[model samples]
Target: MTIRLAAVAAPFGRDLDECFATIERLAFRARSEGASVLALPEACLGGYLANLGGEAAGPPALRRDGPELARLAGIAGDMVICAGYCEAEGDLRFNSVVCVTGDGILGHHRKVHQPLRENQSYAAGDGFTAFDTPAGRMGMMICYDKAFPESARSLALDGAQIVVCVSAWPASRTDPAPDLADDRWTRRFDLFDQARALENQVVWVSSNQSGTFGDLRFVGRAKIVGPGGEILAATGVSAGVAVASLDLEETLATARRSMGHLRDRRPEAYAAGF
Candidate 1:
């Protein structure tokens, strides 16, 4: 089915009310543009960590069944919205994402891969899974998860036609590039988005935090990439929404017609590491 998808790149801080306002504004904009699915940046609800250091306290931990997510679902209305927040489970907190519509929650994903001092703040997730949504069969991941090919691959193997990766990725700390576009981390961010989509032959939606947050400077390059690794819509290095329209079945058919990446996978060939 044909669907309009929007990936967001905007700044979100520690304030929940302010973040909801931003999400409401952006959701309205996307809905007006006929978007069926909207992907918000990682930690867009309560904000990401000030730094990768273990010293800083984490964002407010929210429950999946709490009023915050319920409010988010109400704001979502008919549109499928994917957003990140700190998930609370008793004394432990997890870096997680949730997909919801006006009716209720559809899917949830806890970020499986932790980078640097992230493990110090939150417990790690154990697996990757795909679930059905109004838009299509979808999967989610956060920040550093996209770096590993296995993450996206696992989703695709689980029947995800589209993958949304929300991030709070920042530019390099040492020897930072004068131009954000030339920054190595920014380049890696873009490369991972394209490479994951191309290798798995799935539609890729990448959303990231924009502007500086405490000690880290985020690279806003939100984009919708086609299964062929072509960028359909991108916000470049600024805060904005990248929107695109395409027929999921047709797009996947076109990309997989000749040499299907999933069809030709040699899982048996690589038994040592995987």
Candidate 2:
């Protein structure tokens, strides 16, 4: 079966209404293209403006069962939607991805690898899990998690054919030296996406936040890569969605045929490295 997917980019730090309006427009476009699911940028709902010291004073933590989730669920049609947000559960805060459908939120993924500023605002997730959706078994990971191959590998091992990544990657960081030049940065970013797709033999879709947040600027290179590490579709440094059609059965066949490495594993012989 063919599944159409979309990756949507939105500016960070926008209000809830503005964000939802953007989502509505993107979802409409995706639906027009017969997309079965649309994946949106990280922290798109509340903006990525986290007040570390004031998190305790912020409004009560929003849960998957909250009004916001219900509102999103209502907006979703037959297509599935995935987006990132800050989650509050008791005293702990998490950087989370919510998978929504017409029925409501299907499942949530707490980011396992917290990056620099995130550690001050959110707790790390303990484990990874895949959620069954109308299209296929879907898995989620946030920005920094994409740099770790194990994250995607775990999802693939768990039977995820499509892995969605939502991210608010900083455009530039003052503390971490200057940002990599545009060409270098783009190459590095695309390499990671390609690596994830090739290693897991699964489709990789990423949605990233765009525009400047303070001095930091987001490199909006949202894209979809096929199982063999081919770029199916990509977006520029502007806010938009990249739509592509994916055939899971064909992808699986390709993976199995090229998995000579999988059949020739020597894991037991490599214990000396450990």
Candidate 3:
């Protein structure tokens, strides 16, 4: 079966209402385009700007069981919506990606690797997990977590055919000005996407935040990569949605021809190292 997927780019600093409006618009557009699932950028609901003072000063804007979830559930009818939000589980705060369908909230993934200023605002998740859905077995990782190959590999091993990544990657220069032939700004995440796609042989769908938030500007290269490391659809540096249709049968064929990594194992050698 062919599953239509949408990678939605969300601009920064948008409030919940504004974000919902944007999502509704995107959802409508996706539905028109025959998309079954829409994936929104990281921190799409509240904003990616981590207010250090705000986390400590007062209560969070939306808790996991708050009205926001109900609103999201309502917004997401039959189409599956995978979006990012701050999840508060009692005293523990986590940067989380939630999947909502008409049935209500389907799954929640807490980011395992927190980067830079996020360490101050969110706690890292302990274990990797995936959820079975009508579309397929879906898995999620937030922003910086995608940089690690093990994360996607873990999801692929868990029978996930498509892995969705929600990111608010900052355009702030982490390195000094370098002389490069190509655009260095995009190279960082591009390599991550290619590596993850090639290694896992699973469709990698990444939705990133665009525009500026405070001092940080977001990188807006949202894209979908196929199991063979081919770019299925890509959104340039702008706020828009990129849609692509993925075939599980094709992915299974690729996996079978490529020695079926899931079936072959060298785990004993790796475990011996541990």
Which candidate's TM-score is highest? 1
What TM-score should be assigned to candidate 3? 0.90
lDDT of 2 by residue, 108-180 (tens): 8999997666677788997678889998988899988988877887787788878999987764443332433
Worst 10 residues of 1 by lDDT: 51-60
Any idea how many clashes model 2 has?
A: 2
Worst 10 residues of 3 by lDDT: 174-183
Residue 167 in model 1: shift from native, Å?
0.4
Clashing pairs in 1: none
Stretches off by above 4 angstroms in model 2 are 50-60, 174-184, 260-266, 269-274
The candidate that achieves the highest lDDT relative to the unseen native structure: 1
- Candidates sorted on TM-score, descending: 1, 3, 2
- Candidate 2 positional error at 189, Å: 2.2
TM-score of every candidate relative to the true structure:
0.98, 0.89, 0.90
Q: Which tens-of-lDDT digit does each residue in 31-65 have in candidate 1? A: 99999999999999999999888746779899999
Between the candidate structures 1 and 3, which one is better when assessed by TM-score?
A: 1
Compute the lDDT for candidate 1: 0.95
